[model samples]
Target: MKNITPLQVAILVALATAMLVAGSAHALALAQSRVIMLSLITGISVLAMVYYAINYFIYRKIKLIYKTIRSTKTLGGGEEVYSMNEDPIGQVYDEVQQWSKEQTSKKEEADQLEKYRKEFLGNVSHELKTPIFNIQGYIHTLLDGAMEDPETNLNFLKKAARSADRMEALVKDLLTISELESGSVKMDWENFDLQELLQDVFDSVDHKARQRGIQIQVKAGCRAPFMVRADRKKIRQVLVNLLSNSIHYGNDHGLTQVGVYDMDRHFLIEISDNGLGIEAEHLPRLFERFYRVDKGRSRSEGGTGLGLAIVKHMLEVHGHTIHVRSSAGVGSTFGFTLDKANG
Candidate 1:
């Protein structure tokens, strides 16, 4: 039975009473000649009152059920009333139960994610601290040796110099990654020639490529002066990092290719190398900070493990994306997009 409010019940009661009085008055107008009609009118009014009272009791019960379902507090202090076996109220209770369960699950997941984030920060701190301490120790050794032995002092000084340079590189890469991540590093967006940029990057790494016997090939579909809107300095850094990585890991007699595709909306630059390619499992996490597939080899090569991470962040800030395609023994390609000049 649907619940009726107190006001509605009162209204129905008054309507019934008015009908009974009117019937009685008609009977009185016909007087003694209509005694049977008067008796019938009184009986009908009694029956109507009985019906209203029964409905009122049922309505009150239904209303009580509704109040119970809507109440947030439990019947005891801690037990929610999820259902009552009857109409409207039972459905509401079921919905509340489902919502409560969902909330509980989400809260648990949030707690777990927070825990993982903390662990990641701890790991990063440890990684950074080791390099810093090594650099500090090397400097102390160099300074202390100057008073004891002249030849040893010079050797220590060179070692200390190398350590300092490594530390500087690490710190620089860290700053670049932080700025890229925080979105504080703004690009100088202007029209520049893609071919010129490629030539410059190639020339910068020419000596290294020559020493390693690596050949670099450049292919451009765009005209000599293909213009793009991007930060020239950051883009140069990205190219240097990618190209150096390729050179560092390339196979003997391998070749590196630099290609540019100028679409109407954007410019695509791809750097590819026939190197010892990355494994399948490590591909997805390649952009993660300080992630290395070959940690020992990377350390030996003086890699800070933040190069690709920096590349990813910088490209993202420029409203671009980078993607990699590789086969374990074949080769790898690193590609990124740059916005085309407006006019």
Candidate 2:
């Protein structure tokens, strides 16, 4: 019943015609041979006409519909591109329904992606505009009457320089992230002491942390050499970004801690800070490029806004994931895993 064929329809119609022809001849008392001959000829002729007409018109149209529906994906390959015995009309209905669903899902995803792209572009424009405007205004003032005032001229020049520096940092971070996403940046992997790297990062960021009197510490017993296999330079960059983040948002005279733990096959490195942490809603998008919290002067304090994003990508390329835990007013911890060095 689900698979009624045109040929089956023709056979059923022919059988009914045969019975009708035989009954009419017998009612008129025609000869037995004449009745049988008439019935056979009528049945065969009807069968041929019906089968031929259906194939020529209805069946051909059905085939065209099925082809049109699948032509987009025909060259893509499938296990059974053609089914010989299936009902053509039923197949077309199923294909159309499935295609409709696929199109709907694809459109939804594209729309979401488009929305995200627009928002990202807007953020980039806003981030660059402030510094660019500041630099322009400062230069214009210095070129005008401010140049005659030595005291004011130097201050304007310094402000212009800072704005220019910010622009440069933003451009550099953008380029780094693009390269990381396009897979053009390769990791130079090596075995190194993770604790040693931590200390180095601490020393590097000491000058910045000192501005706020923040203490950067390694957790007790974690200062020892816990060797790890990773891109030492990239890992250093990650630690510096996280540590610097803590400093930017941490309370005056607050504390930042770095810890290392053994996770059987990998080492878990975490950076924790007693800072105004992110809210639950923002946590999901915290690592996104150009995403900023309302309270932090991340950009004003030399942040490029792409720090966390770059860190995420750098870890991802090494077959690892970064995790963060934070809430408003409380502290936050950012952790990522690295393969432990083989003994």
Candidate 3:
């Protein structure tokens, strides 16, 4: 009865009322019953027709409205609208409320994405502008009388070349990130000695470390060669970027060390520096592009501010993640893990 339609209930009420009227009139008198009976039959017939026509029109309109609402739900990518047993109007109200909430959530997410997009564009522009402006200044000075002065001519040319190189590095890093995000970078996987790779990186950056009196060495237990499977070129880039940061950010005569740990099927690698450590607040955002704890010092060290960002992406491509632990004045450690080569 609870699931019965409004039209069914209306028909039931009309029939019950007609039966009561006929029963009461027949009890009044049996002599005039024939005349009353004829009139009663005619009235009942007319009432039945009127009730049927009215209910037919109302039910048809209600069904059409339900179908329209169902079609709307389908277009909105909602679940299949089921046949309503009780009240379709109430169900429609509930669905509309749910859709409104979902739309509000989507709007918030879109707003956040738009904000990030704008921030990224601004950062890129600032990074490129510095080098471009420096190059223009150097060229203009050289063109003005410095070109005729032998002492300043070669110096200005070198400075201009360096600025151009910085711009080139920035562009290259940007391209690499774009390729990585677009899934266009192909990994060249191979089994290689992790210890040997560290040595190569150390040798590559030895001169730079020496200029600042920094000592870079592997931790004692990690000196042994540990084989891992990964893209050799990308891993090399990761190592270079991490080591370069340590060298650039370390204090004079500071120590930078890398440690290795065996974690069953994986190897954990940590690059640590006892220099100008990062504050705890900055650790979460360390991998964001162009995010610098010390912007002036970072720029002075000739970095494109994309090294750590690239490092994070490269590791992610290999199904890995990088983490950082740091304190303001004590030290900083960056760690990542790679799969061990199968026997």
- Span of ten consecutive residues with least summed lDDT in model 3: 78-87
lDDT of 2 by residue, 94-184 (tens): 7778888888888899999999889888978987998999999998888878999999999999989988988898888888889998998
Which candidate number would show the highest TM-score if scored against the true structure?
A: 2
The residue pairs that clash in candidate 1, if any, are none
Encode model 3's per-residue lDDT on 204-230: one tens digit a residue: 999999999999999987888999999
Q: What is candidate 1's lDDT per residue for 1-343, written digit by digit as tens?
A: 2654444444566556656665777656766536555555655665566556744675456557656654643333443332222343445557567657866888899999898678667756866676678767766776776637878777766776777788778878877877776777777877787778878998999998999899887854543676878888888888999998898878868899988887679878899999989998999999988888889888888886888988898888888889999988898999998888777
Task: Please give each candidate's TM-score.
Answer: 0.69, 0.90, 0.82
- Candidate 1: global Cα-lDDT? 0.76
In model 1, which runs have C-alpha deviations exceeding 4 angstroms? 1-116, 140-147, 220-223
Candidate 1: Cα lDDT at 117: 76
Q: Give the alpha-carbon lDDT of every model.
A: 0.76, 0.86, 0.84
Top candidate by lDDT:
2
Error of 3 at 71 (Å): 7.0
- TM-score of the candidate numbered 1? 0.69
lDDT of 1 at 4: 44
